[model samples]
Target: MPLIYQLLLGLVLTLLIPLWPSNTLPFLHLLRSLTTTPMMDGISLAQKAQLHEVADLMLEIYKTLAAMRYIDAQAINPGPHNVSDLLYGLDPAVIYLYSILPYIDKDFATNTAFFNGGIFADFRKSDDVEQGRDPFYGSPSEENFEDEDGPYMRPWVTPLSLLGNHGSAIVYDTRQHHIWIIDQEGWSSTDPALEGVEDGEPDSINRNYFAHIANRPAGDVLRDMVRWYRELKELPGGTEYSDLCWDHWDMDLKSLFEKNGWPDNFDGDAFLVDQAREFCALRAKGDAENPLGEVKKFTDWKNGKADRAKKAQEALDAAQNLNETWKARFELWNAERSVLRNTEELKKAQQEADRLCPNGVCQRPEDLPLWELVAVQRELGWKQNDLSYHRDWAEKSKESDPEEAKTYRAAFYLAEKEVATYEKAYEAAKADADRLCPGRSPKSVAGIKDLDQDDTMRDVQRRTELDVILTRELDALREWAAQIPPEANEAKGMADNQIEGLDKSVEDNQAALKKAQDWIAEEKEKE
Candidate 1:
């Protein structure tokens, strides 16, 4: 990765970190201290676990957002689509919605249906499809399931299908027709639906099934459904079909689902469905009372829905941020581990190199005398190539290593000295030659000039190589030097400050917790 990208990632990670299970060195120590005991008090354990889960969720959400931070928010729209479409609609905030969704397996064909290509798409996977299968028909597809109320009632099928997967509670605003997918999750856990169905009444079977379904496009399906439902009732609960458009589908559908033997889970789904019914009831009371009065009623519900939506969005955003921070921290930590492993490998290689070139492992003093004899033979020109080969081998043996820059710095200095001596000698020889045979021959004069130029160029090349070696050595030294421990006092000061801040924050939180507990106790006593 580029340094700029690493810096940017670091900045992002810093900005979005969780309170618990943090990778920040200071917090890691604090967390370790908190979990030192083998066993924790049950309540405390639960609380800590909850906190961890929340943090993890937050981190997951953060990761999701970071992954999708480039998406155009307005362009993202999910419908009665599949998981792919739902994913397409995912904003950073929508990622949180996914964390809480039921199905995640892409292989499960049942969950393939979804309202839009967002989190709901996950709910509409193959597995979910299998689970939420319409017992009434062997095939779960809309084409296969015959519409009992005829073509005019075809639109009712989607709302009814949505009722099954997401549960019955949903709301739509009167003005903009803003739709909120009510989370009736907790309701399912405790709902009467867990009770077994009576014999010969399959429709009454207790099903914990919640799934998003694939259907015709959301816009067309919804518009047609509302149109059909309004026709089904001469008056939409005493209101005209004109009033029961997209804006009224939220209410009318809720009532339709309830009237159609939708199980009353007694969870929030049931509550919200009832609420929707109430709002529609109020709307049906007509405009004679006060237009502003009706507007207030609508706004009140709108405000509540908006508040829920905002909380859901916040939870999603926090989860995404938290997930992203942890992922980066993990990636960096993994990279660090790789570096450590490479360092170990390099050490092994060095050990092997040292073994190959042991000072007294193979050669003795007698052998050294033979080497000297060989050198003398070379100097006498017994085999000039053989002599050159020995010299080259000896030089390379000294030079061969990535660490040569550090190890050969002193050697480079000696080489520099040798080059200086050669230059001085060559200069003197050139001067003597010029004085001894001035203008004796043109060829001779040109030969001296060439020697001077060649000598100068050779010196420049040697110096350049020497400088390169020195620079490499300097860089390696600096790199290794940076690994040294910081001053004790400097480290201690930072540690003290961190501990102090952590202590203060913990104390404040404890105090607030105690106050909350006391208030709860007092309120219970009063009750």
Candidate 2:
């Protein structure tokens, strides 16, 4: 037997054997003690002894294994001593032992059951067991299991054949009654048995015991083990065992542990504080990297752009309103000016009518002979020889024939005065007609036989001239009212064009601004 089993047996003998009665046989005393002791309330003496034997066997198997290796069938089969066959022969007893030993010492049974084998073996290899051959030689197939990934078999066997040469081990800390699976490749158990496994109760061992180690090299495995050991030591109230199996590993993981600023003896409180600080730093970093801040910035820019667009639109509207107002004012001013111009023209026409016809009579009332007027011009002619002879004859007659000379002279003077009066009237009429109708002419009175015939001819001439003047004035006013002024037309065109251009600009800018706002809103929603 291994020294560990010897020591355990020695302890049991020393601590529990003495409680038996001295009067009875050693076996009967043990049986009585087992039935009576609170620690062995449910287990019989025979069951307790079987549990101890299983624990010793498990210890012996563990002692024979290499570091990180399990005592599976491959490690013991086809050898000088086949522990696998031996275990198979005692399978029924072993099962009974596991079922009953928990009533006496649950931790011992649990540790022995797990470390001795059968529990954590690979199910794929165990399928070979049905063929009456080694359990390590078959492809994994799910036949009776509810889940393809769940446990496949329940027969107790060494885990070495399941693990092969490159896998890890499941270790049981007998002193602490704690089970930990340390596989090079990470492993986890969701089996119902390991759910709430705890110390002192073998039934609970199936529930609470579970652990894993990531796939790594030997050195890394050692480092991880050291780290776990330190962590366990840093737990509240600390662990009971100080010298764990880490010393047996050749790797030095102390530097690796200290490199993270965690001392070998670091407490749990310090670890918690460090983790909190790291969490806060990560949160701040996330805030800095988030795009929500950029979204807000773009939103601000969008608002500013919207405001600018609004103001621009308002300015454009004001400009358009001012242009319309000016146009209306100009139209009103033109209307008033036209009215004033018409009034002035009417006043000038009235003054012209008074100058041309003072007493409503357009001609003189006297009548003169056209022949006498012509004869006078001939008699008084200075450059003509006939008028000189006529004047001389009249002078001679005055001496020779006074009556004849007197008659001649009287006719000549009267004719001359009549011609002068007619000439003055013609000039005045021509001037009045020209002033009232600049491009018009008056009728010729030279051809009129009745110079004083109730002023009919003179009235006709004045009326014709006045009609021409009034007609021309009316045509001019109509022409002025017919069309807009050149400047006003140009101003109106500019206003229309400006308004159109501003409207287009506002439309385009509004669309662009709306697009920007929508994009910003979308981005914010994503954030």
Candidate 3:
């Protein structure tokens, strides 16, 4: 029964040993890891997704632009002086499509405003006036809401509101993959509340107050849409549009959109097809076409337009797909960069800790005083190495004295403590350096702009402590190395070779460190 119990205990011990936790390092390592880990890990997956979306959208716009150019080329064949039948048909589409293209499927543009109107707004904000005229020239006045040409023609390129002379809003719902047009009561429209009306009235503001126009006759609407679309393409999400909404510190989503040259509310569709307005005016002039003839002509025009549109749509789809591909690649690149930075940071923290503490003896008074954790860390590391070497030596030496093998067992434990001390000191020094220098490393500092400042002094002191510790730690390491006796002629030869190489490396490292010190001094002098 006792034998069985012992066997069970041994099995438990063996299993638990593999699961044993590592001894804790200094508080600094923990602190640095805590502070930096979140930043590294905080990268939003949504950001990658957004980048891909932007790239996709840009490519899509590029394709659409290409198609428009193709259509334009067809319209202007045989030199550049005459308009073709195609020109008349394509003009309205171009004007309308291009006007809204810049703002489509973008988070930046307003769903109900025109891009030109936005530009005009900005021009007004800068107090710009055309030819020394009032800044509001041609714009709607408080008393006269109509533009110079009346409600049919707006100072801005938006469509006439059915209820009033207001701009309509347009947006592309990427999720639903459909265009959404919103009606807004134009500035000319009187407010219902002011007229003592409430919600839910047919003409209430809550209704789809903005008119929905078509992308048929592109003319002004197409031109504006194309211009804005091209402009957006230049943004980072566009071609240069920055990831920061309004820029890094801006919190307003709408402002960010506007800054990127997108409409706060797009209404390109309202102006795209002003057929009713045109027809009404033409009918009033008694020049309207016979209904039967007009219908036949309209069918022919519509069929031709549909054929071209189908082609344009196919090109747009291909472009959109390409854009998505590019975006995906960009996201992957960003993700990789982020991961690499995080890994490098982690490695840097570990290296810094090792540098501060050469020997692992955290509790030793000498280890505490030296603080040259980096220089001493190798020495501390050697304790383990030397102990291992000694154990191997002792194993072979067992032919001479079996007890020699046992001697390293205790020293191995001492070596572990010594290594721990060095580790802690190294970690602390690294943390201090990081705090003092932020991103600038001591070795990389070419000048000391703030050398004499209190902040600089704190870092300098930490560095100085590290240097002093390094000096003393090396001396102790030499003493320890000397004590490692040769077990055999072969062992002695190997130890001698290793010690010689280590000594040379140490000297070279010290010389390089001295250069770093000189740089610090130079910076101080300049200060």
Candidate 4:
């Protein structure tokens, strides 16, 4: 109905810029769901978590360099000196990073990894201040927007034409080099469209909305920094460089961690750690034997994405072609029926057909399982969206306007009823799809031919030639839904519940699946 192929043919083209590959995107999706969703009870704040992620890798180095610069210039309290025990228990490294995060000076450090050495050198311990959320939600007075008071007015937030430009530029590059993961707290998280966005899909997220979807996970960014730091420590001739780093940090930054306290960042959960390796071949990126599993998943997903799109196009073509065939047959049928209607033959034949089949029957298309699934899912999605909207309106107005609330509530239930109808339709279609192979989901049922299906008696009035063509074409549609490798199906099935939330169990399962996929792909390449 209504050019279903147009809906089937999605906006599947890859951006000139690379987002995460499909497999890796899901992994990143899980991580963001865990750490970033707002007002999450018992979970860590995304900003703090992001800060701490890259903290161990480079915090001391930043503090050391900042202090050295100030000391060289004879400045007092030149860096993160210390916080009193009465105040807070954060490590000096984290305190330092948090303290200086508001700097938006044109002269801000622009090192490869956004490592700060030059600018913070002049900053003093006395200058450190807690930057609450005022700056992002600036008042009409414009003090917060210009950051005139937050950073000691060091960097003017003016030049009205280029608002958020200085900060937005750092969002992605910092992640690529694996240093600073600019937090999304004051940025895209506030977007109204992002409200109620599924934790599993970052499709509408726009951390750098003006430019592109900055799809890199802040967690992965920090992980990358950690990996790089690990490599730096182990690399040949790195000791000399580290000695210099140690010397600069020793006076203040390093001592602060030893003297005060920091959040526990040790990866000591041995079971989870071991589980990760076994599942995803989870080594640090660029490991000799098992490289980054995320990258492997991404590569496979990317290479296959175009192929999947091609399959979708083939399906679209088949659907349109079938429509054309159906149209021709339909015109002939109408002409024959019209001619028959002019005579007494029409009534008797119709009576006989009616006797044979109560309602006018025709063979259900062989492709009904998946093609009907597409249509059912489409209707289901629309109904679900309608239900969500009405439900939300009902909740919001329940207290303020009881009558309006009741109206919306009624509408909500109506939508819910429609949603249930479509969902049942979808499930029925999925159930009838003969499994392509054992363990494959109905979603994975492709255009494989099935010759044995009954076509003679039931729905005997008409059966079109297009049905077989539709089945063959629908295979492309099937793959479009379940693009994950066949090996991943088990992991995915196991992960379904855990993946819904921050259940640690599914993390390991996904890792294992990624690991299996990586190994399988590697072996095939070798062959």
Candidate 5:
């Protein structure tokens, strides 16, 4: 893999990251003592293991997005790029001045589904090679000499070969600060080369980012990668559509497998799934715990008088700059940015946003258009449903996973807050319509296609939601009743009784749905 594949991934900066576990490394502590400056714009951190996770997730997302695009457009003229120059060069931020993959030609496929010729070749493998290492701490499988004990742990060292050929890069961001492993390009990461450092731990972590000086924990970076992976991986038909896992990289992975002297049959289809299943299986059997124990706390070994005062002073000073550079609402743009590969689309959007709402600022109702608010309202309904779903999950999962239940509860709370915010925006939107465009219902809003025939159709929405729930309940009851053994008389009777009740529920819901449909028709006819 080269820089082009990373560009295709949208975040070349995050494709390869150096990681430090949350409570382990002295990096964060050392920073607390020394530097008072925040990370530079678009500058963040990541670990090698985290990079591997990101690589797996992003390749899958690219596959899904590519498939979706194949159904519509026949225009993908991607080109190769050597981004390592800009990333590790004299003035790193100079990249934004020009487009990297300046290709003009386009291609089409004849039912091959995203096979626009050689364009998909580079996205076949992932590795961080010839980049973040020095003196090459020989391959992991290599034998140790008289001075060594075993195969050393290949941690992402700070000292690196800055001029190493065509590996990953630490690129710039238009907005936001969060570390990611970007431009992680190499083949045969199917057990590629590894390097270790004297000061680093002896584990098989492939890459790390900005480890030379930066000190944020790699844990959060890894967590976000997982979340991103889960979100995009679920977007496609998913494991039910199992071929998506390989992202058409099966051949490349197979080649690497063969070259590395591994098993003959290396199926990329289960590349990610196998890891998840195997990890869970191992974890279920027994955790691979650290024999010497893990680092649970940080020790400021040089806790001098000046160091303590400096730490206290920095903490006090940080209070003044709270909420200055970033806010939570504007967060996650980096994640979204990673997938935004269309420059023309992004440019048009940016231009349009600048025209309608300057600097991403809008005067709520006045600046809010009817269709935009309608869209917002429609999204809020989804969020409202999400709020309810998370609430249900939080309650239901408590018996199975209390920790996951807490996560659901937190998501539920967030959805509630999000819904509340949307509700306020909606009220403000309605008030705007009432004040500015008087006597106009949603139907009166010209050119808005997403709206129902009339506002009374909201009842149809509610009734449809009710119908779906009742139908699901009926299906569940019938399935349950069928599962009950005839010999288990008491249990069978209970199932039969519940199924009867659910049958009535479906009956009543169908009636309600019909009524709603009738009302909507009547309202539209009257109009």
Candidate 6:
């Protein structure tokens, strides 16, 4: 037989044989020494020593196995054979043992099961096992005893149909009464429909029946499962798997198998750590650029603030000019009112003259004809020779007559006052009315035929109308000025608030940048 076959035979015998009774320690020890002895190659002493050490380690594993309770082939229901039938009738125990034993005896090179793209079944032939037969029971095809919901129907086992299939290792833990299906990608035994279904029948199989061992890029849970197995086995001297056991076994066992190597999808933890470091460096770079970003933002805010200030000043100047215009209008209005008042007095005097003289004889000096004055002198009965003397006497008498002289002087004064008042009022009203109405001309009081009633009333109405217009314009100007102050204040306030907020933001960013710098410096020092 080949040396590899001898090794395989030895391993099978070790698993099958029960430990000797506790009383037969010496005999058991001798039997183990003879059977578990290393096969020495025809090499130098140093090479021989190394082989012996490896042999000794294998012996230790055997001793640990001796203490463990053997799980007989019969105890495994829906067992390995049933699973292996899907692998074209390969022995499941060979696959299980070949998967785990290499971790202990690193020099063990032969795999006694299907792995990668080849089968290493030299010691035992699978040709005798019936193909496409029910693996649970060695029954004929016509029996129809296969269950639809059994392990054979599971989707995870589909890989077993391939000729050179490599799949997950299944281990039955007799102590826990549960089977642990260890796969790199986690497995779910519960039907997908029954997921998160808590309120089901008492016997319903949920996540409780399944144990998934996911090996993520960052960490592998299979390592924990291996540790749990080791604890259960309780190997002598508390032997531990290597530090790299936590890493993916496919990666850890790269050198051991001929075709099996690290998984193609594996991205090592170092790559992730480097990626995280790069991310941190990028964040630090972003922090370093914060000041410049803030500078640009502050520049925009400054420009906006300047624009708002300029707008506020313009608003204030517009308000001031409006106020000046209103003041000039008000002064003009006041002067017009004064002229109207004087014109009203002149009108009242004319009415008084009409009351004092019902007849048309009491005419004003400007209204009297030259013949009327001479007739009045002739009625005073003075001869031509004594005309001068009489005229002097008549003038003295007139001065002496208080009522006549008072009436004469009042009428003359009234006519002169009316002329002056009308001229002043007309000029003022025309200027103001022209400004207000632009193309329209003011109506003249002199054009009215009824001097006492029509002219007086027209003059009063025009004054009132002009007063209304000036008052309304003044009110609008006041309203505009009133609105500007609040708007200017609001603009100023907004600019101030913007600058203040920008300052605060810049300060905050600077502080963050400082902290980032400190952190970067600290990280550098550590490096």
| Count of backbone clashes, every candidate in sequence | 36, 14, 85, 5, 22, 0
Clashes of 2: 14
Q: Which residues of candidate 3, in runs, are more than 4 Å off?
A: 1-460, 483-509
Number of the top candidate by TM-score?
5
Per-residue CA lDDT of candidate 3, range 270-335, in tens?
Answer: 211121122222232221123233334444554555455555445445554444433333333333
Query: In what order do the candidates fall by TM-score, top score first?
Result: 5, 2, 3, 4, 6, 1
How are the candidates ranked when ordered by lDDT, highest leading? 5, 2, 4, 3, 1, 6
Question: Between prediction 1 and prediction 3, which has the larger TM-score?
Answer: 3
lDDT of 1 by residue, 308-405 (tens): 55554454455544444333333333334334434544555445434433441322322332222222222223223333544454467665653444
The 10-residue segment of model 6 with minimum total lDDT is 235-244
Q: Let me know the TM-score candidate 4 reaches against the reference structure.
A: 0.17
TM, every model: 0.15, 0.19, 0.18, 0.17, 0.25, 0.15
Winner by lDDT: 5
lDDT of 6 by residue, 1-527 (tens): 35565467667656645664667765444444434555333333233232233323323333322222111111112211222233543333333322222121111211122211212221112431232122222223232224323333121111221122323333232112223333323332222222343432323223222323221211122233233333432111111121111123223222211122212333333222222222223333333334444445544554555455555445545555544434333333334443454455445544543543334233233322222222222222222324344334445557689655544443343333323433343344335445554553212211112323333345545555555544544444344334334335543344345445545555554555556556656767999
* Per-model lDDT: 0.34, 0.36, 0.34, 0.35, 0.38, 0.33
Q: In model 5, where is the ten-residue run with the lowest total lDDT? A: 290-299
Which stretches of candidate 2 lie above 4 Å from their native place? 1-12, 15-139, 142-154, 158-228, 231-265, 291-527
C-alpha positional error of residue 272 in candidate 3 after TM-score superposition, expressed in Å: 37
Q: What local lDDT does model 5 show for residue 452? A: 46
